[model samples]
Target: MSEILHSPGVLALELSPGATPSSFTLGREAADALARHIADDLLRLLPAERDGAGADQADLLVLGALYDSVQLLHPGWPLFAGLSELAHHSQALAGAEGGRIVAFGSHAGAMPGDALQPLVSDPPSPLLLVPWTFSAPEALATDLGARMESVFMAKGEAGRATADFLMRTLGVRLEHARYLTRHDLCALICSQLEHAGYSALWQMLEFALLYPTRSGEASTARGQKLVFRDGAVHCALPVYADWAAAFGAGRSREERVTDYAGWLFELRQYVALLGAHGVAVRFDGDAGATSLPAQRLAEPDPSLPPPTLFSHEARGLGVVVISVAQIAPDRRVRLLAHAWPLDQAGFDVGLPQFAARYGASEQLVRLGGIELDATADDLAVTLPGPAMH
Candidate 1:
């Protein structure tokens, strides 16, 4: 904290146009703080200290963690100053003891050409990993011990903060786009759908974590499921993020509803990604329709209760949104969304043809009808081009 406050022109963070950091500024942080985290990771890899041999000597020996941390904070290129700083401190500390100054270089998959042509090293040391040398039994006990420590340490907020520090540092060290997982991608897509006018974006993360909700009514409490059947997929939002605020106190109703609007377009860009990958989407039927797999089960079947999700399909079932999550290997995925009604002319993905309906009968949801001011400006960012890589 003091270092960040005192340091001038310290690199802080980096992010895409609309993306937020994971817990912290991520790419932006003081170079030293980032270096410290790297140092800590290497320290963890050392054997348990019986006499502080590894502890005192490890910092004096390895500069891998610090340099790797820098790469993580600034991926695609390695900073010479940052690397030199680590090497200088480490070599000085070792002080002619023949202590090896092992430090990180261009990361795996990263090339010398990836960095600036001016980049140079004073004395180079290759990146290294701590080898697993413990016997099987010893390794198992160490694993269990670490797990136990995690459980007990989480009791303290300090532990949680430090744990997060380590986790985020290690996360970037593992891979470039390693922050996102299947579950997070679900939340990401679902959040975007919510930003859209599509309202069925509830409890979506629960589905990603516990996919294939075929276990009966008990699964309903967990929320909706993204289903694929007969060459089509179905999904419905079971809960809303604004509604989650009910459990806590913060925003007023208007503020909640207003800020709530951006959830969809935030992820709206993903819509085209789905389509580009040969996915077909349609919309039909009411979003609040009472349909579920339980519809086919016996009346009052105690074993099969109704889940919040819709099980079977019907015509005119208006779908709010459709999102997809890749299932690895070949990027195959299960489409998740509300029930979309099929049409001969394809998806009528809009409020309805007003000119054709002008002579016909259809109810328009007006501001007067809903008793809200329609004079408010429309606030939404149109989806940009697809950016899936």
Candidate 2:
């Protein structure tokens, strides 16, 4: 039982950006090339599911880092609407069970100097925007460490107190209960103790058992010395089967098992309470599985003129690349472009213009009229700036 409690399985997935081809730029050729690549990857990654079947047969899906906006390629639609539509489609095809989607966005503070302020009010999607001001990696790590330590100490003390109470209530000798750790003993006590009496016993043990300590040495005239300890002494007694049997006669074994199980439940509740109060105790089975659907777009007709490219320069600063991807049955299509630096010097100034150019290009593709719906948001693209000279 103890061994089973100690071992649990967990799975982790990390998504990273793929390499950009040297020929890639903020133009039609780059957009078409990226779109093709993304489509291929998504098809390979997401398994096609049969209708009326449960996800039990489906594989787990984890989205590590998803960026870029397909709406940027087709400015005619609302940005968030496009994103939502795409998410819906992707989740439907992927099968929701055991799925997780974690998107990465730059903390606004990470932007150059004061460039973050203007964008603060109307920040991008909550799922997409992680403000730089609040997302310091080093700071978050340090705080998490402190929180974990505090939680560990609190849980340890609680377990010890619970164990001591069990020993006293059941009249079990401390020596007989030494085989169990404080946590195990606590679990045993909770399982065996009456619900009505458990809280009082817990409070009593807490008030009397946990505290501070001191020690002193006394020397006799003959030079023999002895040590005496004072202040506070904290100790926990072990749990014994006899104490459990004493609680009920006919079903002693069943009662003992029930008591143990009850204790485990209470301990879990306590942990959750601590978390609600901002204590960071790590627990298994705490998070829910989530999924986002892929995006689809209508295909464009071949008779239309080749898509035109719009270029934006950021003065002395490098290009702000924007790429978008749309998901289709056979593959994921992407759109690539860049924002011209606004000589006007405000965060909101040139963004809409860049979005418009990108969006129009996407609309051209959709008009070609492919049978498959290229969910607009299903596409993924990158935004790499100019190389630092």
Candidate 3:
């Protein structure tokens, strides 16, 4: 069987972290202009060939959305397949092609339906990516890929006219516009995560992106460990047996629970970050234990029996239930807790409501979690903000 080949690439517009854009996409005329500029830049960057091995033969497909790099890594919607299909259909339309450039603008009569809609900007890492492709033999494809990667890294800035036009039309603060192979885009995202103090977590995330067939493990400085495998992130919650032996063994139960609360808060932050990156998360009591759906930690209700204690409820009741279970004869037990919904508004306010209704001592033992006795007041503790790495 002959091997099938597809060469797909993306040109990214990376904005400063704090930079703001008024619109997520461009209007028709502006989109067309940007597409033209991309074509011109690529033609100048890639040498012309008699056999059409240059940018002249390439296809540039522009979309009207800012993208997060992780969205590009979605296994469900492989980037090359999606872009190629879009380009194929667009190219077949008699008037849609403009010398190898096709822009998917909001005002363009051919807007994709919601199901096929691309991922839009969130918190705005705000990469306006224009994906391009080439049809060539395997060797020519490899050579073209190398040269594009090299030249784009060296001098891929958008032309002056293009930059000005983007700023004026899209109302964005221009930072740096560059060409990136899809791989380069992933590296750029990994670099940004490292700079943002997620260096430890980046390794697993990168593996989830590039090495989906294998598993990867990593740990945060605070001792939280995570593994990426089978298309989801399985995190070993901090209050597990091994972690307790190292950090909680000598501490009082109250102190241990307090420290555990802090760790639980940090886990929430990680979950939010992963969600932003479009990755699924699950919980593991130990590094090698059977994984539990992350929702168990996200919305816990220990009001039921032992096994069902960790089962998740559809709606979060605005409090974390630290459910305790005995697993051994030596007084060893497991403590499972969840964090408040960080995404909801007035969540902190819900904290007080929970405390007022539960009372201090009555609910802890009744809930089948830790028996806080008279000091149950501590269970309603206010968690601190995301800890700085």
Candidate 4:
């Protein structure tokens, strides 16, 4: 109760075991881009407080296992890519104070900072560690760094039980147990981008080298031009060796997997946010295998219970997240989409604005409109701004 009410702060990053990451500073643009990408998803995992004036509205700390995992996956890309970036969003989140980080369950990834000094040029910053295990307080302290102090301790199952205990002891009905999918994670990234105030230069790929802008200008010094190719929309990367660092290129096999994961995560988030906000939604197929009847979506009501990880499979053929959102400058709505089968990322789902195609993006647009873009594969239309709100 004291922890939930008094310490209205959230430590939302994922953690994993690892050594110190190589030195690299986050660029202002890239840092802002990364922060914008993950904000909403991080907020979702934090505690909420409706009755108090500023009860549940705490800044989120997107640190931990998943964050550490990304560094391990792309060692060359700096450690904790978004912390410095998120610090810019200090008005909303705690940024990188370190001490606010809370650990529940196992923290197999945490390494003592002092030990990494000889190998790592700079160690991780200081953090406030809180452990919620009356069950295993010592292990929790050790994970947070041996001298760490736990803000609260409780005895129960790992996740929801801990949350419930806070609710019971704190006297606040904290939003119940919720499961987040890769889809929601991606959408949060998109949401954060929208929130970050970048109305122009945008991130088309979550883990990519090229993030295109709204105009004819190039995304980096490498000067990659915006071009539509292979049904995937992008600002084509000109030289892998020539403009390597700007795009995070050279790490090919890993980046290939990144596009698939990043796009899929962003897509689901786009669909849910659009639908919950009252945008009309229609799945691809009719009342059968693929699509659901067109309808205004229900706002996520905690009183009705929540969904699990495997829930999407029960819906069949999978839904291509399609919606028209009111993103920057447009008081009205612009279309957005992430059809799983389609290879495109960050498309202007607002098809009437851009030219057409015979691809799945075209299929989704046709559901909302009449004609398709000309089927020339090389022809890609340039959108005026970032596809964010």
Candidate 5:
């Protein structure tokens, strides 16, 4: 059993768009160049801490993969587990002399994906990381960890030559290359998501990542509820009552009903974020008085376009269909909401035709197999276009 190191660090690269290669992976030459430069950087950062023989500073092993900019979910557990394992292996092989560096690079191509899915993101975010571990005596490791963070924060720029080499080879416009502990990375991501109006979503994600063993709960601005436990997210979709409490306060009942579409849009946005994180979302149907039960479908019903929102002129709004893939069949089941719109074309016109003309019906989020209990009579409508506003 390889134990996780007490002190793990990361080299942070802040990249701006500048004709950068689509992939984040560095080939043999680039990877080797990066490793050498990182070694030099570490040497300069800690000149006093040489190995026992005083021949080399420490063992800094950089992983071959360049990791994509992740949301800092789970601090660094499974995300950086492989790096920890690699360091342990190297130490065992070499008798454990020094610290290790685990690097994660990326390219839009053949590189393996992490626990987080959608390996390839459109318009990649402006960040990349190289994770490393510091192996030393407990006292020295603690002191070194504190020093490493401050050193990298203040003067952790990559060597000028290395930065130039990377810019030319990777084709990314350079912003600033520095170092940060995993804690720093977590705070950075939290701030970023908060600035982007995702504070509520971050709360749940952070809890899911950091508190995997404990049960926790979170809610969206629109009153959608989420419970995290047993390695999955259980969501209780807001009913008309919950929706009204959030958005219908001052407005008349009719006006609130008319604006119901706004709530549906918000729900879709939340679902999309969960899917993007590859979070297994289980719609909790029995928690509230509203009986909105959801179950797993053997396969996606091709007849219906993915998970969509359907609306009609007279009916105000129709159903907000939601579908999520089956992640753990034994412990959990996926969810899908089924509902139809009210149109003059009558029930005979069918959702397919009704969606084509009156309601443009946009697919909200599509994952895997899931089904909703048809008991909820309050199916609403969806607007046109797929993008969440």
Candidate 6:
């Protein structure tokens, strides 16, 4: 058995767009929230002073969910640099007992440019924009041991001040901070689930970590049996013995059938246990696929029509479409939104109509079998798409 270690604190900051004064105001509110949540913890928030100074009594410093005002003040500075400066300043303000600085920000479509372009060309600096994780700090402390000295970096400076302020107020460090890859994070999640007795989820998560799905192929076969392994866990339709084969192997047919039935009962129990913990299970044979057709509605037109409304073969069933579009130079659009089932005519016409209404192109390419409610937004939207390989 592996011993699992936990961190002293885990903090999350949400960075989105807002007005200049409003953004700053929101940052302050978020900082206060962090302070309240982690009261009695040594943390310091920043942007309380100019010239990038520190708060003297904090244990950890965080910065960002940066606003436009700060970015405008230092326009030429790379976004992460401003974030780092904010963290450094907060650290200086809070006379902390040498804890890690944690900053949180977006890694998705939040930025206008290539989201993958390094925020800083140099080594790991103060400003580190990291994906929001509900369990990052604990995982980091466990994985990186004592060398976890770190800061959160984000795509922009929009919410940097708020994040910095929050960390400054509520964060405490047991050691230095170190960054973890997305895969590492997922693995940590699996470990947590395993601890929580969600062994099935752990197995599925393990599968997802091992054999990540390709673009649009969220579920696939493992053999003659239709196996659904999403790099996380393995799920499948209930197995059925070929009746013809069973008849041919006539010796002790009843006993073999009884054994198969017993096995299936145990499998159902396993699936039920997963369900008890809010993990969803769907049998493959019972599941229906969402279909989006590919057809060029207009001739060489940049502004294409929307998809038509097709028939609702699977009405009342939830269907999520994951669309990945290349928006600009090195920038891509990954959208995951639920679509109510459509009648066949609606399927053929509704999407094109919607596209036409939205002034988007009508070239519809089908990426198959996305998770029922999963979207591109749920995961990171880096250029060249989500499969790391």
Which one wins on TM-score?
3
TM-score, predicted candidate 5 vs. hidden true structure: 0.64
Question: Ten-residue segment with the worst summed lDDT in candidate 5?
Answer: 367-376
State the lDDT at 298 in candidate 5: 40
lDDT of each: 0.27, 0.25, 0.55, 0.27, 0.52, 0.32
* Pick by TM-score: 2 or 4, better one: 4
Evaluated at residue 247, the lDDT of candidate 5 is: 62
Alpha carbon lDDT of residue 385, candidate 5? 47
Q: Would you give me the overall lDDT of model 2?
A: 0.25
**Whose TM-score is higher: candidate 3's or candidate 5's?**
3
The regions of model 6 sitting more than 4 angstroms off are 1-26, 29-92, 99-312, 318-389
How many backbone clashes are present in model 5? 26
Let me know the TM-score candidate 2 reaches against the reference structure.
0.14
15: Cα error in model 6, Å: 22
Which residues of candidate 5, in runs, are more than 4 Å off? 1-3, 49-58, 71-76, 87-118, 135-140, 215-218, 252-259, 286-319, 322-389
Using lDDT as the measure, name the better of candidate 1 and candidate 2: 1
206-325: candidate 4 lDDT, tens digit per residue: 322222222132232223333322322233212122223444445454452333234334434434433222222233222222232222222233333221100011122232233322
For the record, the alpha-carbon RMSD of candidate 3 to the native fold, in angstroms, is 9.0
The candidate with the higher lDDT, 3 or 4, is 3
Question: lDDT tens string, model 3, 1-389?
Answer: 01134456676776766777776556666666777776677777886666536765544566544455656656543555555566657642122222357665555433354533455555666566655555445665666777777777777776777667777776777677777876777787778878887776677667766687888888766678888899888875443334456667667776765565556556667777777566777766432211222112222234432321221112223234433232222323333333233334324443333333222111233232333424332232121233211
**Model number with the top lDDT:** 3
Note the clash tally of each candidate: 24, 51, 0, 26, 26, 84
C-alpha lDDT of residue 308 in model 1: 21
Cα RMSD for candidates in order: 19.1, 35.1, 9.0, 22.7, 11.1, 19.1
Predicted candidate 1 versus true structure: per-residue lDDT over 244-313, tens digit per residue:
3332147554553333333322222223332222232222223332221111111222233211221121
